[model samples]
Target: MKSKMLTVLFMFFTMYSGFSQDFQGKATYESKTQVNMDFGNRQIPEDRKKEIMERMKKANEKTYELVFNAKESLYEEDEKLEQPGGNSGRGRGFRAMGSAGGDLYKNIEDGRYLIKNELFGKIFLIEDDLEKLDWKLESDTKQIGKYTAYKAVAVKTVKRPNMQALFRRRNTDGKDGEGTKEKKVEEFIEKEVEIVAWYTPEIPINQGPADYWGLPGLILAVSDDVTTIVCSKITLNPKEKIEIKAPKKGKKVTQAEYDEISREKMKEMRENFRGGRGGGRGGARF
Candidate 1:
């Protein structure tokens, strides 16, 4: 009887492992952000403004993919490389300005996450425990592709760039204003954004793009007024298994530390842009 029980337990364990592996898959998402073209003090010709608008449109529309299994997921932006001698559709009047999309990995079962961020040409690897979101699930349901998705809402405090404060006011306290000083000011405004997410329990995985997770299902669509991300395609149980790994390259830092570093860098960039300016006030102390 003991030998028989052992054999039965071994078979059950194998079946469960196979089931988990079979449910692994990949999802592709299309993201778009609605942004106002606010060029402060930077004047451009009307025709040039049109070109910049077109470029901004392409830049705001992005493609991302999430590869996941039963426990963990890796998310990153998918970029289309411009081949040599290929027309990029980008105008030559202005340089195409863009930052590297950060990579995020989350372990659902263990409540762990790793974020690899590149800000102002500096790399930072943020590794910390997952932040539990207080999501309010609703009874509303809709069809996303073939899956039935349910609605959920979360309030998140996010740091947004203040375009008006891009240029700092200079100090005029100088001997006949012969020399000037540049004042570093805070450029980020902290505010709450309502996040709406649609998830499907049929997938049986608690995963989503970016830093969103902990739903009873896999998130299919997420929007927060300004930005929206929707799943475009999904491939389940492909022939080759997806490899999920944490990002290891970059200066090691916590999430809070990284935020401080980012703010400091932005201040430096603002000061550098204005050349030589006078002292100003009204920036955050920390």
Candidate 2:
């Protein structure tokens, strides 16, 4: 048994060594996100609701590509051109469409990652240590296209805005104190989500979409409850050289810093909408 184990280790090292010399690939992926919107108690016409849902669907559908080698990778959403004289016709519901964050560049050897985020018409470059999820390996196996894949699962905690809490109003009775008559707005709250990934040992590279990596093999599919990104096409060891470099534009910040910035901006926007002239004269009064 010890001799067999040694043989396995030898083969693993041999394969990884070959990767350093001649291993590069490009992968195309399709990303889909589920949209859920609540219009509160406002009685909206059925026609308007249908129009909102359609626009939300279009914004959620996206395509991306990942170019990678043994040491690094670059993943970016493919830019889609708008049709001539086309109007996006986005509304408040459009925000429910969600975003994939932005372009990501990872250097596995250096344990580094850089992400470009566009929030509130501002660009931020987040540079930080690569996010390493504590993935639990499963014995399950499946065939995805021509590759045999294995399963892994991870739990991640993210801070999300409490949208409902933003609209909370305090009761103003005849006898009311300061604390009893005002609503406390919660800017953000923490939520946990599960990530399931399928990877193939055939590629022998530790890489995946977005901030997902640290696996023993190449990830072909990754899904959370609301979003899923699946590999549609993969080209390994192409004849032409591929470049895997970091994104170099935007104001630099850390992941935590960027998250704070995003939250503040979102809160400001919400407050503005609640008080603007277009928001019905004296904002929304409950």
Candidate 3:
């Protein structure tokens, strides 16, 4: 038994050592977030609710590509052509509420990350140390494609927009405009949610899509409370090497600072919406 164990360890070490030299890989991910179409206490026609849900579904589903080496990775969304006559403005608003659309560069060896985020027509380079999650590795295993995957779970506290408030119908009776203003103060709130990730040792790279890393292998699938990001395809050591570089074209700020900026912007938009200065003739759509 000891000899067999030694042989397994030797093979793992050999594979890792081979990859450590000049390994580069590209992974494509499909991300989708489940939208709660429930508008609390809002009386809307069923047809209109269906239309809003469809728009939200389109905005929530996205594709991303991650280019990685031994210690560094760059994850960015795969661009798609906008459909003609599509509501681009409403789509953008929903996307802004969902996830950060940016070039995310992570350096696991150095414990740092840099994200080039464009929010509200302004660009920001969010530079900060990676927030390490206390992952509890599980013995569960499953097959993802040809690779065997192990599961890990963690609980994370994240700030999320109050979707109910955002979608709630405002009293147009002009009796409680002040109350609306006060409610906008809690546009975002912190909530704790569980994250589940499945990593495969076959790739033997401590990398994953987005800001996830520090596993024994490459992550094949990860899901949080609302969103699930899964690797659809992976290419290892392609003929053309992909460059993983941190983006440089933005005003630098820490993650906390950027969050504050985003929150303030959302607050301002909410105020504008309350004051009937938000959207076009139909008022804010979804």
Candidate 4:
């Protein structure tokens, strides 16, 4: 009886991995993100937490129109997660537009996004150089709809990707392999991410948000800083053959450029909003 059961289990897992690519589902994530500046591991003051909070709070809600299928269906959506209130008069994230779309796998791989508003739209992309999947197979599992999946931890790095190699010896579109010319940034470019997914061999596709894909099932939960965007609520096949793709608007830059540009924009906005002045009797502190 024991031998028979083992064979059945092996057959089931093989089936599950094969079917992972074709699944489409929805999920929600509960995240606590804290941002810190790094100039060689220097510690920032605790009091400054409010300032960071204020910057995020001030950021305007952003949305995007994700178009899947060679220009299939499109929807307008605010892309970034936000706090419920507006920014102070100084204005931070003055033009934040957070949204996205595409097929389960193809969308994210296209690697493009619109930041701020349509007028000030910018691009956001990620270049992952991870070998194999980061998640591990676990004996502990859970049921997401009909699929059962295990958890895994992906420990890897996110760097300012060198676009020179992409150009393949073409000078017109090639960048120097050295990365950004600016002083080397001290941010923790690489991150250790943990993902919990429930996929079955019923599907066959390798697609997940950047840096994560290739598992037995659809990735229901993923966290890797910018990629942490998770499924807050899931309604599987809310509509059939839901497609995922990249946003088309604004400028296009490599993953490395996007990383620095985003944080710098945030930094500049926060800096301008700093030590809020021109206040009443009780003024805002820096």
Candidate 5:
């Protein structure tokens, strides 16, 4: 059955090659992340805890759109108006858990990517080579909408922000000096995680929602350890052609440089929290 599917996909791609120039697709994706908030030994009212969870959930749920053709694709969030007394204010710290700021443009033909990311108040244009994932195709199949999707898995090593360190309270045991506090920098640690993607050959573009690509078909759904991004809607060959262009604004930097800058900024924030400059009582806010 796998061989049959591949054969049919090859034939379909060959037939669609002539119309590739005019074939463009717009896919809307709904992205959500599961967050486990631990307040350590601090005792909190149940009502306040529930409120915090609600705010975090609202902050983590997001909508994105991907515009793609044969060679290049652009993915960015679809902004929405915040509700009254929403999580917009306290959601800054949780920004690292979701998709990065600005537009992500991938050129599959050239194996390059350009991402526009904003950190604190600085805008950075991250230009780097596209990360090629070693995907292992599986024989499992499932139905996503009106398409028959196949399963593919890939293991990726990513730098995840240490949430425990961010909320850890300073030790004020007064071991060395009177009224002294132990300061620890919040850092990102590297870990290996498995990525599962569902693709359908009906849309033969090697594009996915975020930085995921190089699949045999268009990826409809993808999930990692804490987040899941799924395509909710797809529009093919719309009346108006969307211009797929790379963002030119912001200071140019590589991915590594951007990460280093983020680490330094996080450290600064941690220090500020320790110095009683952050939220009330519990060192850092959610």
Candidate 6:
């Protein structure tokens, strides 16, 4: 009975120990990404191309955050946002129909410290190419931030959930905005993506923009294929408390489970919408 009672008390203490302390800081980096698709040898109208490019503009300029602490570290790369030049988007994430976004996550709190800041690390994403891969790492190096930081490299392996290589289809009736029917076919789809990041323990704040964490420090900068996030500056332990957040709460799945869910959701979206504007405004990244 004493042993059981001790175990229960230990569990209680552990749960209560997770009260995150107050912190304030900024994370920033540059991102670069490529969006490709097949037009099926069909010629896309100029207007359609213009519209797609507009969407791409938003995708390339999205932002994402990485968060970490003593418990877990997750990376949600390339999250898109509703507005441009904002701090809400995930890491260099891309999307198609609705609002393009980015998100990446991982849980490594229960594991060993392994390599603090190596030259390269492998990361994995959900896509036809990455679906088979159990894991993929990337290159990194130690640096400085609010504290000691490690530099992460770019892989370009992951892609945005809603993102796809699209080719425009000409409308049958080209009466210049006269209700001309248009078609958009997927040209390319890839899941693997690479990003460079900088993490530090300066303020000992383990919060990033999106699902990024795991370093002995916090993420100060991140970037995707074409987009980059640079934490120009930050202030530690302000008057309020700041907690890291997942792309979307209510996620009751492991890494593999989340990948499966995201994949199925994207697949369903593509099938249901076909050549129309499908999916919601949420942004899911590669």
Please name the candidate that would achieve the greatest lDDT relative to the true structure. 5
Off by over 4 Å in 3: 1-14, 37-43, 87-91, 94-99, 169-185, 279-286
TM-score pick, better of 2 and 5: 5
Error of 3 at 37 (Å): 4.1
**Among all candidates shown, the one with the greatest TM-score:** 5
Output the TM-score of candidate 1. Answer: 0.77
Which runs of model 6 end up more than 4 angstroms from their true locations? Answer: 1-34, 63-194, 200-209, 243-251, 272-286
List the candidates' TM-scores in order: 0.77, 0.81, 0.85, 0.47, 0.87, 0.47
52-137 in candidate 1: lDDT tens per residue? 77866777788889999888898888857866874433221111111125788888888888877766446668878887889887
> Could you tell me which 10 consecutive residues in candidate 5 have the lowest summed lDDT?
89-98
lDDT of 5 by residue, 1-286 (tens): 6796677468548746756676898999999988787653335688998998887788778899999998899998887876787534322442352245568999999998888876654677889888999998887889988988888899988877776555555544622123455444346768899999999877888889888997878999999998899988999999998889998888998888777777766666655654546643533321
Report RMSD for candidate 3: 4.3
The stretch of ten residues in a row with the least summed lDDT in candidate 4 is 162-171
Instruction: Give a tens-digit lDDT track for model 6, residues 1-286.
Output: 4564344335434543544533233344444455454343345687987787766565565444444444433333443435666544332222331112333333344332111110011122321111121212223345454454555453545534434322232343532123545344333345655656665534443344443443334567666654556664455444554465433423233444444544554555554334444434432223
Error of 3 at 66 (Å): 0.4
Tens digit of per-residue lDDT, candidate 2, span 1-286: 4564344345546677667665899999888877665443234698997897787678777788999988899998887777688643221221221233678899999999888766644666888887689988776778887887778899987665555444332233522134454455566667789999998767878899877898777899999877899998999988989977788889998877776666665565456444433233433231
TM-score of 6: 0.47
Residues 1-286, candidate 3: write the lDDT tens digits.
4564344345546678777568899999999988875465456799999998998798778899999998899998887776898644322442242245788899888999998877755677888998898987776778887888888899988888766656444666643434543233376878899999998767878889878887778999999988899888999999997888889989999988878777766666655655556533433321
Residue-pair clashes, model 4: 41
User: What lDDT does the true structure give each of the candidates?
Assistant: 0.69, 0.71, 0.76, 0.38, 0.76, 0.41
lDDT of 5: 0.76
Local error of candidate 1 at 180, Å? 16
Q: Which stretches of candidate 1 lie over 4 Å from their true place?
A: 1-22, 83-100, 167-185, 276-286
